[model samples]
Target: MTGGHSGRQAYTGVPRWLYALAVLAALVVVLPLAAMVARVNWANFIPLVTSAPALAALGLSLRTAAASTALCIVLGVPLAVVLARGRFPLLGLLRSLVLLPLVLPPVVGGIALLYTFGRQGLLGSTLEVLGLQIAFSTAAVVLAQTFVALPFLVVSLEGALRTGGQRYEAVAATLGASPGTVFRRVTLPLVLPGLASGAVLSFARSLGEFGATLTFAGSLQGVTRTLPLEIYLQRETDPDAAVALSLVLVAVAVAVVALAYRRPGGRGPDGKAGKQASGERPTTAAAPGGALT
Candidate 1:
């Protein structure tokens, strides 16, 4: 009666323990970040960042991450289209398998890659016949990064496909547009924001990949020592340098999240992608969806 009289019933119903748990979670994430920021010595921040080793790691990470992002795009786009548009048995299982890397321990993933693609492993003999080597090389770094980052791209694009729905694609088919043409013109353009966000998130994930690279690629300087690897190495020898490198990663992560969430084409915050170009009323996509009708 007291809560109703004061119009505070809603607030009263929220369990105090739940509020406490939320605060605890916030502190768990924030306190460590605050500590890292506090440890940063601004006086020599520029020097620490510009040091030769740091620069080499940064350059290598950027290179591998970019390559990995490209790989994710090439592979993820089609996979997303299939997953969204295809209605098959085990669809949910397939999605879970696609997203496994996101939840898998990075070390475990690295080990799996090592055994699956290692020189003495399953595909080793076949690769040797072709004069190709993957283990402990820059190629391996890119492979590892791609393995870990691909799920982000696929998940993002698939969600976009679902949200955009099959309505426009269906209409496009009705208009006599070839499947390829409709995909290129109507579907891709409509989901450009999803693609962009996915790419960015994939890039960020690749940039920070550490355990996989260390295990599969062996962390050679300028060859496989990504920024995160460098940060780990620096922590043992130089804590300040480690903090500086961490700051760079933290900054990059923030930028990536910002880019992914930003409104597309002057749309409001909630306007995920611009209105459907198909101009037909947007409808919830039914099962069996793809970019092409």
Candidate 2:
């Protein structure tokens, strides 16, 4: 195909009417954000967002989101690898259960957590005996966030693992690399981008978590109340503050998602940027052996 024709086909291959639908889809997302921005009280946006309650909620949200994302990475990576690479009975059932949070109501998850950790709950009494109270506390908030956000990381990394296949892994094993060495040198590197993207998505999901945190951990200023819960509370009393905080959340989420998709060295998918666009042929190195070494 001619370069210009190929470029045109890249975008126009879909049905002509789909372009209109695509525009409508974009509008559905953009219009609400536009209205929110328009409603923001620009005059007091700074003061409103900087208020003590707002700052506390934002700080709490950031801290819990970070903690939850770390937890998701530690736990979800292994789960994803198992789902994608391991063979066993009822594997499909296990995979579905792991991804349940993606579709389950946040409130239901919270209630389940509450029953597991609340006083008189299945494990709560046992925990209480050990003096480790969890429900209605900051730790509950982290658990709630992790419960809901874990699926995002798992889904992302599992898809990446499946897409990447086991070619490099097999090659590394053939070259005398141990399983751990192959994973560290071959599998992890191949899936690093997906893992990073998944972690960012998990952080974003945790940052916005509300129903689970509220139902399991009760909203308390500077404790379990995250920015979403703060926005909910402020909406009833001070819409201006709510709007300001919403904008802050939106901005942070946008920045994080942008960072997740950003390419190394700021190059586009076509690899056309800076001196690389000046006809320097990219070189490919030998795989497996060099990587295992």
Listed in order, each prediction's TM-score against the native is 0.84, 0.88
On a 0 to 100 scale, what is the lDDT of residue 139 in model 2? 95
Worst 10 residues of 2 by lDDT: 269-278
> Weakest 10 consecutive residues, lDDT, candidate 1?
284-293
* Per-residue C-alpha lDDT of model 1 across residues 1-293, encoded as one tens digit per residue: 55666775445468899999999999998899999999998899999999999999999999999999999999999999989988999998999998999999999999999997898879966897899889999999999999999999998888888877777767767766677876877778777778888998899899889998999999889888989999999999989999999999999888887887786565532226566533544433333543233
lDDT of 2 by residue, 1-293 (tens): 66876766545358889999999999999999999999999999899999999999999999999999999999999899999999999999999999899999999999999999999789999999999999999999999999999999999889878876787678777767778877776777677778888999999999999999999999988899999999999999999999999999999999988876777675532223334233432222345655445
lDDT of 2 at 278: 34
| Per-residue error (Å), model 1, residue 94 | 1.8
Q: Please name the candidate that would achieve the greatest TM-score relative to the true structure.
A: 2
